[model samples]
Target: MRTLQVELGERSYPIYIGAGILDSIGELCAKHGISKKSPHLIVTDDKVGPHYLDSVVSRLKSEGYHVLTHVVPSGESSKSLDVYEQVMTTAIQAKLDRSSAVFALGGGVVGDLAGFVAATYMRGITFVQIPTTILAHDSSVGGKVAVNHPLAKNMIGAFHQPVMVLYDVDTLKSLPAREVSSGLAEMVKHGLILDKDFAYWCCENGHKLLALDAETLIHGLERGCAIKADVVSKDEREGGLRAILNLGHTIGHAIEAVGGYGRFLHGEAIAIGMAGSAMLAERLGRDESLYGETIRMLKAVNLPVQLPQDVSIDQIMDAMQHDKKFTEGQMVFIVPEAIGSVSIVKDVPVEAVRSVVEQLKGEG
Candidate 1:
């Protein structure tokens, strides 16, 4: 197994990446000081349960671990206070203790919600992430976990790192085409903001990566995680350098919130958001050629480069106002100066944002 570690001092954790590593969950947990005797909770979603949850449970059980399962409805809606409380109640009812560890055995939603539970239960408990989708390659690693409030996505979250992240590439075999495309968007984002080489590699090999070809998927997953790990290592709480990771996320989150999360997969919204931000960058005269390149790369991967036809400018503005990146009621946007380059724009004028949205809407 290829392993990467998140160096967060006391909260440090390891991310294990390889094909068929789900079978090694028991040993992984054990290595991290988790035991069979300790109460273990497996949190998954309806969609993931039938596919992999049972196998995960059996793996841990074979190691003589006592395991319980809690499956939530799958989708962005699950990231709500109601489901968070439900999982917490289940953990409490099961008598999960400080020694206990929670196993998140699904995609981004499962990882985020379960990790949030682990962070809050009994003050804090250990959690392991078993990501089942490509999009999770980013979400599972960073310590950011939380549910969406009614007003905003990820408004209530904590910086609770996991004890271990077992990224079994095998699990992604069942991912829908949309999910694969969604994940590629993030990998694309990594290249845009940090590594130009990786970005070019993605443009060349996106199809192979999406096909779930074993070697290509593993390479992309490892490379993406490596970039994310480097960024998080320097700024765990997103106080500074880490904000670069939000290359498309600032406007992306607003789009998601306005469109009601499920309308566009996180990556789809990012695809459009990145395009819009690139346009904004062009208008601001940061680098016209890079903006054109951004559009080309996004379209190359089948990601939407235009805003949705149904979305209104007012809805987009309302969502941006509620974005977590807003400071002192000002919206901050990360725009690309060039491929493998980005700049943060704070207090972006409402008129500038409106003009871009109008132009995008008109084009669509």
Candidate 2:
């Protein structure tokens, strides 16, 4: 197994990445200080329940852990306040305490919801991440966990890092094409904002990664996590250096909120959001050539580089206005200065954003 540590002092944890890592999860948990006798909750979704959850539960049971499983309805709906409340109630009824830990065993949605529970349960408890999707590779890290408010995406959340992240790349083989495509959006963003060479590498090797080649998938995931670990380590609360992590999120989150949470997967919306941000970058005098290059690479991965047909400019603009990146009513966008570089620009004119929205909509 390839082990990468997210060194956050007392909050520190190691992310184990490799094929078949899930098979050894019981031992992995024990090694990480999770006890067999501890009351544990494995939070997953319906979609992932049959495929991987049972195996995980079996392993934990064999290790003598008292494990209870809670499978939420699959998709963005699981991140609603109602579900969050229900899960918390379940944890409470199950007698979880400060020592009891939550095991988020699905993708981003499960991780966010369960992690939030771990953050608040009995004034905070331990949480382990057993991410089954590529997207979770990003969400499972950095400790930014949350559920969506009725009005916004990830509008309510907390910075609760996991005790450990067990990324079993083998679980990804059965992932649907759309899910894989969605996950790649964040991978693309990682390359764009932190490492240009990594960005280029993704463009070149994306196909192999998608095909589930072990080496490429592990390497790409490691590189992406390394970038995230470094960023979060520096700015745990997203105060300063962490803003770069928002490379495509301002526009992406806006698209997601306006389009409705389930309309597009987080990564799918982010793919389009990156397109919009790249276009805005050109208009804001970042780099004209990068605008085309960014779009081309996204398209190569079968990611949507354009807005949806039903979406309107006004809705997108409204969502962008409400974006968390906005400061004092001014919009802040992350635009590319070059292939491997990004800068946060508060100077992007609203009119520029409007134009990109219109243009992208036309493409759809």
- Poorest lDDT segment (10 consecutive residues) of candidate 2: 322-331
**Which residue pairs clash within candidate 2?**
196-340
Q: Residues 64-117, candidate 1, lDDT per residue (tens digit)?
A: 899999999998889999999999999989999889999898889999999999
Q: How far is candidate 2 from the true structure (C-alpha RMSD, Å)?
A: 1.8
* Candidate 1: residue 19 Cα off by (Å): 0.9
lDDT of 2 at 47: 90
Superposed on all Cα atoms, the candidates' RMSDs to the truth, in angstroms, are 1.8, 1.8
Per-residue lDDT, model 2, residue 183, is 91
Q: Give the TM-score of candidate 2.
A: 0.95
